[model samples]
Target: MPLVSPDNSATSSDEIMRYPFDTMRTVAATILSNVSIALSEHEIAWKKAQDYVQSLPDPLQPAFMDVLNKHQQRIRDSYKWQEDFAGALFNAIDTVSNTDSNISTSFQKIDNAKFTGFGHGHLIVADE
Candidate 1:
């Protein structure tokens, strides 16, 4: 039957079918490597925060996750955390890309901006 067909011949002829598990393997390796860097104290406090989060038992995980959430937001807020995150992120990418040609990551900062306005002098003064 001469019916609807695809020119997948050109694109897919030489291409290997990458299963979901393949991408997951790369991502998992990257995460683990980044965590190792984190424990070495080279990575940001956010990394440590992640360690704390992941170490928690599955049942009790979500409750204390707020602090990690805030830490990530604060990384956006602070220049220092931004720098640390950049370095660690790049290092992991480099390691993966160099050893494995299939894996690729272009680490680039889109923008780093602290949210909201400055201290409005509407302070509740401490009554000494």
Candidate 2:
């Protein structure tokens, strides 16, 4: 898959600041895509191996199949781990993005808030 380039001409400063988050999200998605492709390839190879093992003479078939099955399970487990890791990475990026957005919104609110002085007691109140 091709990575998409950001269109800077139409992007605001806020969007520019968020570029890193976008990049991270894209990278995480790409990692997941790669892991899926690898899993597909592994599955194809596994089927071929199984077919080959099954074609072996009766006495040898069981032993070879046993080994293949064990190794296949391990390989599948490894791929599952990779897929899980990628998913976690994507979630982390989303969390960070949300946090950043919240922070930015908070700052904007603070910047726009109007503080007013109350009567002789010298109390202050924010005028929303």
Candidate 3:
């Protein structure tokens, strides 16, 4: 899998001083967006999943949004259990299902997003 810290609390706030809640919210939103894309893409190119996913990177990504951006890059790389895709896919599924919440969302937030499946409002919104 990707190099995840065992704690998984986003412990590394290397740049958290400059970017606060906004960074977190943006990262959360982008990750959710990608999961949606990957889920849809999964059905579209189930057979060529590897090719379809590895191509996600090489696109310009902001530095503050490091989590989503790097996570995407990792998804494109190959691993025996297809760790990258599998990790993203599993996280997406878990967040959706609330199974083992690394990121948790409430129904009120879902209502806030108008149930549109975007901008769930569970993330911190700060930074530049």
TM-score of each: 0.25, 0.66, 0.24
For residues 13-90, could you state the per-residue lDDT of candidate 2 as single tens digits?
443343366776777788788889999999899899988888889999989988889998998888888788878878
lDDT of each: 0.53, 0.78, 0.47
Clashes of each: 0, 0, 4
Which model is ahead, 1 or 2, in terms of lDDT?
2
lDDT of 1 by residue, 12-93 (tens): 5555443344454466566566656654553566577778778989876676687667666565455445445656655665
Off by over 4 Å in 2: 1-19, 114-128
The best-first sequence of candidates by TM-score reads 2, 1, 3
How does model 3 fare in lDDT? 0.47
Model 3, residue 41: distance off in Å is 0.6
Whichever of 2 and 3 has more lDDT, that candidate is 2
Number of clashing pairs, model 3? 4
User: Candidate 1 — which residues are off by over 4 angstroms?
Assistant: 1-42, 80-128
Per-residue accuracy of model 3 over 33-120 as CA lDDT, tens digit each: 6766775675455445444445556462233245544554565442323435545655564454453332334444543553323255
- Give candidate 2's error at residue 59 in angstroms: 2.6
Q: How accurate is candidate 2 locally (lDDT)?
A: 0.78
Q: Tell me which of candidates 2 and 3 scores higher on TM-score.
A: 2
Against the true structure, candidate 2 reaches a TM-score of 0.66
**What is the TM-score (0 to 1) of candidate 3?**
0.24
* Cα displacement (Å) at residue 17, model 1: 67
